[model samples]
Target: MSSVEEFRTAFRDWLRADLTGEFARLRGRGGPGREHEAFDERRAWERHMAAAGWTCVGWPKEYGGRGATLEQQVAFHEEYALADAPARVGHIGEQLLGPTLIAFGTPGQRERFLPRIVAVEELWCQGYSEPEAGSDLGGVRTRAELDGEEWTVTGQKTWTSLAHRSDWCFVVARTEPGSTRHQGLSYLLVPLDQPGVEVRPITQLTGTCEFNEVFFDSARTPAANIVGTPGEGWKVAVATLGFERGVSTLGQQVGFRRELEAVIDLARRNGAAEDPLIRDRIARAWIGLEIIRGNALRMLDGVSAGAPGPEASVGKIFWATWHRELGELAMDVHGAEGMLAAGEPYDLDDFQRLFLFSRADTIYAGSNEIQRNIIAERVLGLPKEARP
Candidate 1:
């Protein structure tokens, strides 16, 4: 077998053997709106994977990964999804922060954090979006000040996914008093368990609280925790965003396919597929999924070389808009039943939850509008958008 096929077979066989007993109950649990489900169990399962050397398979071998090639990494995600494995609890740390550290962090930072991330001993959350700076990360107003040996952070971050559960957060805060628009910012690694940090859960339309508003009042981390030079954090933060669109997203595409298949099956079972309009939409969804896969592969070429570039925005726009439309189609397949709760107090079936949660797919990470602007100015060399 080709090395890629061998790698895929090994992991596939491992998953087949391991996903039984209590772990079998975890399949398809804890993703997006359903993050509340089996979270502790999922964390334990991730630690189990870490123990078995199945986590972070794409990182360099020196960093404790298997040093899997890009093809093998893609296969790893695909097979993980094909096995219906539980949604990964350590993805934020393993995918986002780990790559960023490898690219920009000091050796000491890597020595201190990478092993913990590899082992799923520490969970991390992104501290990028604020009430005033959701998509425009340059507008971040959170500030951190170096005082003696540590940096004291004080600011509020909203839409922080999994913050309530994370052990640490990588924060982008203004360190220079008069700095504005990305300059003089620093990305600091802050512990979330400190007394100065308060995480308040925000219930979403799906009635889950995976997203949170985090208030950091004089929260502190060692001065050495900053990645890259203090004023150059914008560059480092952008690199982290690039890593956010990495190989693991292929696993997400698999989940998307599963959702599409489920929607198609529901339509068939409920006679909705008899409608020409429903049939057309289902076909369109299938076509869109194919396009999404192609765009993802094309985008990965850029990431494989280094941090991805403006072309990454193209994949983001395609998948986010397509997934949102799929959610709408799912609601339509449910017809009037979609509007009703599955039970009292806002309980939702899978389709209902998918419909509501996918509404934000285009809005978060970077809104559709912001992504279009990124492509226009960064990719096409168009004139910058008029700003006040």
Candidate 2:
């Protein structure tokens, strides 16, 4: 086997061996809609991953990582997903903010933040979306002002994933008064534990409370907490979005493929496979999984150039649509039973949860409409959408 293949083998072996004993319960526990499962246990699993040097493998060795090559990083994620490892608690810190810090952060910033991220000692959330600014990130109105040795931030951020569980947030705020759109913003690192920060979980249709609304009323971080420059945060924030869909997406597809296979199995068990339409949809889902993986690999080529570009939108729109459809397929395979709750109050079964949560798949990272606009204006150089 090639070295990358060998790396994959070793990684897979480690996962199989380590995800046992107290950790065995974590297998297939957390992912997408199931983020609410095994609350404390999943956090422990991430710390365990850190201790085993499995967390943040893509980070540079100097930042306490394996400095794994792109191929090696992809291998680890693939193996992790195939092993059905719990969803990581530190994705925002490890994948998104860590790289952003390395690329745009001052040495002091890197020294203070990167190590904790590698250790899973701190959790993070993205403070990008707001009530008025879903896909139009440029419309962020969260404002921050310098106050002596600190920057006081005030604004509300909604649909912030895991904000309630995170210890810090990388926030995009308007730093220059009267600035609009993407300009005059600053990427500030704000602590979530302080008096001025409030986290309110937003319950989803899945009956899970993974998403949250975060209120920052004069939340303060040091003056040096801003990444890049005070008024140039939009650039850093956009780069962070590029990293948002990186090599780990290849691994995501592995899990997605597994979900598709399970739905197929469900169809066969329930006799839905006998129906020509169900079989055709299953076949199409498989083909769609292949398309996702191919696009991710192609996008990986852009990593060396510093984050995937606007071209990444092509894959985003494709996979989001595919997964959403896969959710529908899961429910269809289950027939009428998919509509029933697993328990009283608000409990949901796997397929039901998948169906409801996948509804947000197209909306979260970026809405389908937004993704198409990026492809048109940025990637294809087409005419821009007119705004009021």
Candidate 3:
């Protein structure tokens, strides 16, 4: 076998050995019972992956990574999905903050933050979506004022995922009051354990507090915590969102494909296997997932070649729509059983939670509407929308 093929074979074997034990333990807990201990389990798994030098496989060797090739990184993600590993606990750190730091952070910043990120020692959350600036990030009203050597940030951010459990947050705040929407913003790394920061959990429709509202009243961060120059936060924020919408979507596509396979298996076991409509839907989902996988690969290739583009918006839009369709199809196949809660005596209740969570995929990381607009403007060279 070729070197890449050999590496893939070895990696797959190792992942199979490691992930089997973890998944067996998880499956024994019944259907998706990681609600309470999810973070702990994810942290442990991340540590295990880090020890195997696979946590940040695509990162440079200088930054404590294995420096795996793009193909190897893709293989790692594929194997991770096949093994059904628990979703990451610190996605904000792993996906958004980590990449941003790698690009814009100083050597000291990288040394201080990247290692902890790999080890999951410091959980991170995003402070981007304020109550007034959910979709229109340019309208962010969070204020960060320079006070001598420190920047005191005062504002409220809503729908911050895992803010209650996070140790740090990467925030965007207005540093120049008189400047227009996008120009005055600056990104700040705010530590959440301070006295001025308050995190209140926001319960979802499923009665789970997976997200929080973070209120920053005179939150003090050092001048060193600023990312890039003052008033360049909009650029940093866009870069972060680019990673959020692209690289993060690659990881999620793996899990979504696994879920799609599970739905197929569930349908087969049910009487729906003989239904033509169900089979057609399953086939369509498979094809759509393949398209997403292709798009992800293309994006990775572009990144490797140093020619990254806005094609990630296309992938994001496609995967979000495909995931919603998959959820709907799974629920339809489950009939009434899909509606039951996990603790109930039903077999397919896990799909209920999955379905509800899929609703947020389109809205978060820039709404699908915003992504469509981006594609229309940037990809299609369409006329720009008039600003108010």
Candidate 4:
């Protein structure tokens, strides 16, 4: 209920005062590529945040949220990044699944799930991308079949972030026999601790296993676990995707800004800034970032009306491509020294990890190719690309 400025002032004051002691040591300890570092410590910090009612500030008050305004939410993210706080471990739950449930989940579902997320008592991972279905979500072949009182699920999901640490996975599975593409899919909240589930870490180019391959062979969730009607999960799944790109994107920009500033500092320290091309690229990165902010703000301003439309694809393409390019610039700033690992068995510095991991920026969530297709068909009314 507070005005944006009031909320911002209070949040900034609280953050400055509270991020000290053991928490002070945790600053900048966890993030995208560095998730494997200090996880237990970061988890404790998140619990401290939950104890302070600092988690999920934007959900509905009825659902144990602060019901914060859009401006207040944006301010929270900006300040959190300004403090260089660790990337949250509950992101998939708090940002993606919580909102999706609020919009699509039944009362029983909401009551069962929302409080756990707000408290960070249960961690969740996205079960969307598969080895064969990463970019083309409609290609998901994870099949769940309804039995007497449970749905038995069998499928493999790859690039599943933090699945190794997650207690549950929100899985999209083919639930109807003979159905194809986007039809007959169901979003099931499956517990990961069950015997039928297996999680194998996939070490990336950064030499960290923040992602996993989740194999579900006869995994079971109660039949009541489906979020929408059994066969209408594409709609539910797409809504979750929209949340994945929602207000959190603004916070992500704050991290991007921090990374950019660090890259600029690196260039100056290493004398890379003296090169004319390096200077030009840095300037272009700044300008592109400005354009990204403008597009993202405009997109968010319309939230009162509805969820983001297809034009959201524009923001996705812009930022992902921009970040991937910035990663290249990060390596370029390091020059020849960038080629060597910081040590043995995959010891990489921050810049090395940034350069390697950002390669996936354009590929995950939705690939650049898929985003272009969505824009052309849904946003521009262009002819759909010919499908085989």
Candidate 5:
């Protein structure tokens, strides 16, 4: 086997041996505790993965990582999902913000932040979406004013996932008062425990506060907290979006595949597998999963080859559509039981949660509409739509 393959094999063996004991203690019998405790468990898991040199597998060794190949990183994610390990809590930090910082941040910034992120010592949240800036990020109205050594930020950011539990937030604020959209924006790392910061969790249909609305009133962050040059934040934001829609999708696709398999098994036990139409749908779902896997491998290959491109947008679109279809198929197979939530004492309550969460796949990480527009304008050289 190749070096990458050997690493993957060893990693798999280690995970199989260690994950059960760690997860059992982390989750306890009734599942993780309150939100903070749950996040702590996830952080502990990340520390475990990092100690094994598996947390930031693709990062360079100088940055406290294994410097593993892209293939090895993909293998780690696949095995992690297969092992049913708890999802990493610092996803925004590890996948999106961390990569952006490594690429665009100064050496001092990297030294101070990267190790903490890999060790899960710092939890981070993305402050992108606002009441009016959900799909149109350029419409962000959050303002930041320079005050000698610090920047005072004031605004409301909606849909701030994990903000309540995060130690820091990477926020985009309008630094130039009269600048046009997308211009004069700056990305700042704001501490959440500061006096002027407020976070309110938004309860979803699942009765879980998985996301939040964050308000900043005269929130002050050191001017040195800016990730890149002040006026150049739009590029950094785009880079962060690319990582969010690409690498993050790879992890989700693997987890979704497991859910798809469980749905298939449930269908078989429920007699829905005998229906020709249902079989065909399940077959199509399998094909979709294969497509995602193949595209993700190609992406990893591109990253390894040091020529990353816009093809990750294609993977993002495909993965979202596939997840939505899988959820629909699960609901169809489960019939009435699929609609039941976890506390309903039903056979397929877990699948119901998956079904509900899948509804947001097309919306987050840039909406499917945005993805289609990107593919058409950037990839296919299509004519742009006229603004009203």
Candidate 6:
């Protein structure tokens, strides 16, 4: 078999063999809008995967990964999704921070961090968005100051995913006293268990607290925890964002395919499929998914060459909008039933949760408006937008 095909088959077999008994119940658990579901169980399952050398397969062997090729990594994700494995609990660490560290971290930093990430010993969260700076990361006002051997971080980061559950946060703070915008920023890894850090969960439309606001009041990390040169943190931070759009998304697309299938089945059972209009929308949704796959593949080429460039925003825009629309389509398939909760006390069915949560897909991970601006200014050489 070709290497990619062989990799796919091996992972598919492993998942089929292992996802039974205690882990069997974890299938389809702990996803978007439902992150509160079986979170502890999912974390255990991820640690199990790590034990078997299944996690961080794309990292170089020296970093404790299997050094799987790009195509192999893609196959791994697709197979994992097809197996209905639980949502990964360590993705933020494995896909984003690990790769960034590999590219920019000091040897001592890599030595201390990479193995923990590979083994799922420490979970990490991004500390990029804040009350005043969501899409425009350059507007971040979080500040970090070096005092002796440690850096004290003081700022509030909103929309931090899973900060309550994470052990560390990669924070983008203004390190230069007078700096503004992207300049003079530093990416520091701060521990969440410290007394100075507080995590407050934010209730969402799905009635879940997958996102949180993290307050770092004089939080401290060793000065060595900073990634890249202190004044050039924007470069390191941008690299992490590029990694966020990496190959794991193919697995996400697989989950999306399954959701689409479920929606189609719902339509068939409820007689919505008989409506030609509904049928057209379903077909269009399918087409859009295919386009999303293509965009992701094209973006991966950029990743293989180096860190993904502005083109990664294209895939992000397409998939986020497509997912948001798919959620709308699911509600439409439900017709009037979509309006009501599945049970009393705000219980929501899968479709209801999907509709409510996918609403933010386009807004998070860089909004549609910001993405279009990236494509226009960076990809198409358009004139910059006016700013006050």
Candidate 4 TM-score, C-alpha based: 0.98
Q: In terms of TM-score, which candidate is stronger, 3 or 4? A: 4
Give a tens-digit lDDT track for model 6, residues 1-388. 2498888888888898899899999999988998899999999999999999999999999999998999999999999998889999999999999999999999999999999999999999999999999999989999999999999999999999999899999999999988878899999999999889999999999999999999999999998999999889999999999999999999999999999999999999999999999999999999999999999999888889877899999999999999999999999999999999978799999899989999999999899999999999999999999875
Clashes within 3 Å, all models in order: 0, 0, 0, 0, 0, 0
TM-score of each: 0.99, 0.98, 0.90, 0.98, 0.92, 0.98
Q: Note the Cα lDDT for every prediction shown.
A: 0.93, 0.90, 0.78, 0.91, 0.78, 0.94
RMSD of 2: 1.4
Query: Scored by Cα lDDT, where does model 4 land?
Result: 0.91
lDDT tens per residue, model 1, 112-151: 9999999999999999999999999989999999999999
Model 4 weakest lDDT span, ten residues long: 301-310
Score residue 56 of candidate 6 by CA lDDT: 98
- Which candidate do you rate higher for lDDT, 1 or 5? 1
Error of 5 at 128 (Å): 0.7
On TM-score, who's better, 1 or 2?
1
1-388 per-residue lDDT for model 2 (tens digits): 2489888988888887899999998888877777878968999988988898888888888988888888999999888888888888889999999999999999999999999998888999999999999989989999999999999999999999999889999999999999888889999999999999999999888778899999999999999999998899989998999999899998898889888888988998999999999899999999889998889889988886779988899999999999999999999999998878878987788788888999998999999999999999998899999976
Which pairs clash inside model 4?
Answer: none
List candidate 1 stretches off by more than 4 Å: none
RMSD for each of the candidates: 1.1, 1.4, 2.9, 1.1, 2.9, 1.1
**Candidate no. 3 TM-score:** 0.90
Cα displacement (Å) at residue 193, model 1: 0.9
Which segments of candidate 5 are over 4 A away from where they belong? 25-37, 305-308, 342-348
Candidate 2 segments exceeding 4 Å error: none
